[model samples]
Target: MSHLSRTLPIKRAAHVYLVHEGQLLLVEERMDDGSIFYGLPGGKANAGETLGDAAVRQVLVETGLRVTDLMFVSLIEGELLTGTRNECYANFGRFTASFSGDLAPTDPEVVGVKWVPFEQVEGLVRYGPPPEVEERNPLIWVPTRDFVRGQPRAYYPI
Candidate 1:
């Protein structure tokens, strides 16, 4: 396999959007450079882990919240461009789940956590959708907004 294709599965991750009263549970991820971006609480899944388990673990670890009553909402897949050049990192299999728990920041991975009103996510998106993404990039919002709207399809490269 080519170098690009060989690294296609490097960054597989999952996210859970715990919505209650039109608010989304989001995490302020801290970049190595001290910048931040807001996004649903989640992280990488362990080997052979189920999507649901990954969702719950990520949410609890990042936000100090236990996700119960969770349900599969959507499936998202797309390319993730890290700081690495021409790497073509694949951050596919983004999924959203519903759940409930007291909101708090539980993991050091996140700089901060907040429950953003659904209407406000757009503003956050404009400011840099998620710290996992390259700041000031428009592609970050493409998958997030689609997930929020119950449409998880990513625009596959043509």
Candidate 2:
């Protein structure tokens, strides 16, 4: 078999939008330069698992929170090359839900959790580490922020 055939493909993932008050819940990704970037709390599905269930499980794993009233939202998906490995990330039925419990990072990669102001998305996307990464992933915070602020445009690829 060719090397490409031997390589693995990341087929699916589920991320959640957890909002409370005027802020959105996010997990920290500390870059090599010590700058903090944020992403939603969720991950890929295991074999024979459902997306919503995976969302619930991943949220609990990453943030130690329980989510309820899962409502489907926009889907952001495409294929990309990550360090010479071609992977397709298809996130179907992205969800928003109400969460409760004290936040904690059970995953080592998640060093911290915070409720970022909805407005921070603009700056994070505009001035984040390399515009290239931002372009690859759209301004995801927009939809969640709008939804939180009750200004409409909740589900989005913006």
Candidate 3:
């Protein structure tokens, strides 16, 4: 078998949009450069876990919020890149979820949780969902949906 065949080429992750009272729930993360950015509460799926389950588990771990009424919204597939080389392919699922609880982040990588007003979200988010996806559901945001397919986008270390 070739070396490439032994390595995993595709990565799978899921993210959720939790909205309440015209405000969206977001997790604050400190980037490598020490700058902080806000993104949805979710992460990569475990080896045997389904994407929906991963979404629920990540939200609870990152924001201390129990997600209910989880609904899958969209699937974004594209190539991940490191400079000019293709690093991997990615499959990201966007979900809308309802939650009941206060903000209390447990993940060390997560600095905190904030409920940002809908009007301010576009300005604060670095990677917003694709235009087509946003048009269908303006309330949801997927951090990896900004790149076009067939074009390599920079790989983000989570």
- Runs of candidate 1 exceeding 4 Å displacement: 1-9, 82-91, 94-98, 126-137, 149-158
List residue ranges in candidate 2 displaced over 4 A.
1-10, 32-35, 126-136, 139-158
- lDDT (10s digit) by residue, model 3, range 38-126: 77789889999999999999999999999988886667665444233445556678778878787788899999898887667767755
Model 1 clash pairs? none
* lDDT for residue 149 in candidate 1, whole number 0-100: 66
Per-candidate alpha-carbon RMSD to the true structure:
4.0, 5.3, 8.7
lDDT string for model 2 (1-158, tens) is 12344435656668887877667787877655677767778877888888899999999989999999898776654443344334444444468898888887788778898887777745554244443343224544555445556664534432
Instruction: State each model's CA lDDT, in order.
Output: 0.65, 0.67, 0.67
**Ten contiguous residues with the weakest lDDT in model 2:** 127-136
Give each model a TM-score.
0.72, 0.72, 0.73
